[model samples]
Target: MLVTAEGAVRIWTINLPKAGNAITGADFIAAFEAAVDAANRDTGVCAVVLTGAGKIFSAGGNVREMADRKGMFGLPAIEQRYAYVDGIQRIPRALARLEVPLIAAVNGPAIGAGCDLAMMCDIRVASERATFAESFVTLGLVPGDGGTWFLQRAIGYERAAELTFTGKTLDAATARNWGLVSRVVPHEELMPTALELAGQIAENPPRALRMAKRLLQESRTGALESTLGMAAAMQPLAHHDDEHDRRIAKWRSA
Candidate 1:
């Protein structure tokens, strides 16, 4: 992965173009996890964008390895389950820790776990050439990357089920219509559009943006009262933030 910064936003590019930016094994996850940690620790980084180095955003798993019964696909059924727990499952957990907005700039085909990866982001913007597929079923396999959960949350249970069962591929426009991706731009414009959105998000006060992100995350699963109570707890801290005060002052000046 190649990580670069633009003002308050960080762009992470998956660099395995030769393999269609396929993500697999321990090393990739560890590095990605570390990158997320680094972004969180840096107060200056208020937003992030993830994209691929070449045409494909991600191929998801390594098909060649799966065919060879190597790595996570090796051995007994029970061991395969454990391998998932220690391997791919860790991605959602790592992404869950991000305090700011995460944008997936889907440049091309996001197949199977790749589709799940895009779903894991807080926002998704796709190139006109981009495609998404929950393709595990086509391979006579199931989603081993928490696509079960993420897919439903992204495009509703019914839509998710259809894709999962049929392993149908969706074009960028179809993905946007189904609410999987927020926007679909011409392929050449994808990165520019994503970066522009990231800049908009990055301009906000960092602490407040983080608090809003946290609240938004909790609202998805928490009950009404619990979510409100959590917001109440965070509001006072936001009220006391120096940056918030500065923003207020700037507004008054305007």
Candidate 2:
């Protein structure tokens, strides 16, 4: 089930059966993409919180389906492999595109692609019981999803290489220490804390928040001079908004 809720905040929850919640192929990806588009278009929504409903956040891909596809010979196998990688890559890339602040309320084990999904979010607040691992190596696979990119940027190449090569699992606290997660909370408090953080972000001027997100993302790859030029271009757009006046007046009074 893909659940979407609206308020000062928008929540998108992915609920899959206990059997396994592997994201299958293009159909599942389309549905999630549509959900994201709808949420972004919603003028009433200021921020979004994503979480999974179950003991595990997501199992990554359907193992049974993978086994079935692997048996098919020749070009079919190669096509399936590419399709699988494409499907995996889309999930995290979609999160990175969200205009509003994205909060990952991690509830449990986030393995492989699941780990990639959480890491893609702007902020990650995890349940105490939550565990994260890049288990691709364990399965004789390289990180196919955006994990390779996210891990390296979030913690640097050395740490990302270490984690991926060993396929080591980190508890919430250790993940936080490694800068993989923003915060860790008691299991029962995870959702509430994440919502609170989302709510606070929601209260900020929307345009400014969006620009800030863009600037930060741009700064990651762009030179300082280029970032400054980008910010200069963005300032005019922000100044014309109603929120700008309110901020200027508030600052003047202060």
Candidate 3:
């Protein structure tokens, strides 16, 4: 994994190009968790862009490792369950805890767990060369890494069901049409587009951005009344923020 910062925006590149950027063992997850933890503590980081090192965004799990049953797949049923809980699952958990925005710059094919990984982000920007598939069924396995939940929320139940059941891939255009990705750009322009969007988001007051994201997350699972109540509760805090006052003053002057 490679992490770099551009002002308030951080970029995380999955750097295993030769392996099709597949997520293999626990090390990658551990590293991701560490990076996210560090970012959460760093007030300078307001937004993050996730992408792959090479042409392929991610192939998902390591097929070779699965075939050989040499890693997570090799453990006993109970141990394997524990492995997922303590390992790859940590990625989504960490993402959930991230208050800042995350943008997935899908540069190529995102398959199986890779598709789920992109779904975990707050927004997705796809390259024209990008494709997505929920292909766990093709491997005779289910989406154990929370793909079922994330996919359904991302693209709706029917579409998620069809993709998961058929393992059919959707091109960038189709994904945008389905609302799986917000935008599609040429491969060469993917990172710039993603960073540009992240920069726009990062331009907002940091505390307000985090609170707004929290509200969005709550609205996903909370009732209208509850969300409204939460919004009411947060309004005073926003009003009291010095950045909010500064922005208001600047707007008045302009």
Candidate 4:
């Protein structure tokens, strides 16, 4: 994993493209945890963009490891369950805890667990070469990582169900049509577009951006009244922030 910052936007690139960028056991989890930790520690970082090196975004779980019955996949049924809960599942959980907005720049195939990874991001921007699939069924396994939960929420239950059951892949255009990705661009333009969007998000007051993201996340599972109460409570905090006052003063002078 390689993490670099472009101003207030952090870019995290998964660098194992030779293996189709497959995520092996604890490596991915540790890298992601570190990246999130770094972002949290850096007050200047307001947004993040995640992408892959080389041609493929990610192939998801390590298929070779699964086929050889090695690593996490080789454990006993109960042990396997625990491994997923304690290991691979950490990626989504870590991402969920992030206050800054995240954007996925899908440069190529994002299959199986890879698809779930993109779904965890707050926004997805795909290259025209990008393809997505909830391919667990093809390998005779279920979505061990949070694909089931994220996929349905991304493209709706019906569409997610069909893809999961069939293990079919969708092109960038189809994914955009299904609301899985917000924008599709040429392969070379993927990161630039994602960074441009991230820049826009990073321009906002950091505290307000984090609070707004928290409110949106809460609304996903919380009741409407509960979300409204949170918004009401958070609004005053934003109003009192120095960044808010500075921006207001600048706007009034203009």
Expressed as tens digits, the lDDT of each residue in 135-165 for candidate 1 is: 9999999998899999999999999999999
Error of 3 at 28 (Å): 0.7
Candidate 3 C-alpha lDDT tens digits along 1-254: 99998999999999998888886567788788888898888877899999998889999889998889887789999999998888878888999898889999999999999999999999999999999999999989999889998999998999999999999999999999999999999999999999999999999998899889999999998999999999999989999999999999999999
How do all models score by TM-score? 0.98, 0.91, 0.97, 0.98
**Alpha carbon RMSD to native, model 2:** 2.3
User: Which regions of candidate 3 fall more than 4 Å away from where they truly are?
Assistant: none
Model 3, residue 115: distance off in Å is 0.4
Instruction: Judging by TM-score, tell me the better candidate of 1 and 2.
Output: 1
Model 2 — which ten-residue stretch has the worst lDDT?
66-75
Candidate 4 per-residue C-alpha lDDT over 1-254 given as tens digits, one digit per residue, 9 for 90 to 100: 99998999999999998788886558767988999988888888999999999989999988888889998788999988898899989998898889899999999999998999999999999999999999998889899888899989888999999999999999999999999999999988988899999999999989999999999899888999999999999999999999999999999999
List the candidate 4 regions with Cα displacement exceeding 4 Å: none
Residue 241, model 2, lDDT = 90
Please write out the lDDT profile of model 2 over residues 157-254, one tens digit for every residue: 99889889999999989999999888889999988898899889988888788888889998988999999999999999998999989988999999
User: Which pairs of residues collide in model 2?
Assistant: none
Q: Which residue runs does candidate 2 get wrong by more than 4 Å?
A: 70-77, 252-254
C-alpha RMSD of each candidate structure in angstroms: 0.9, 2.3, 1.0, 0.9
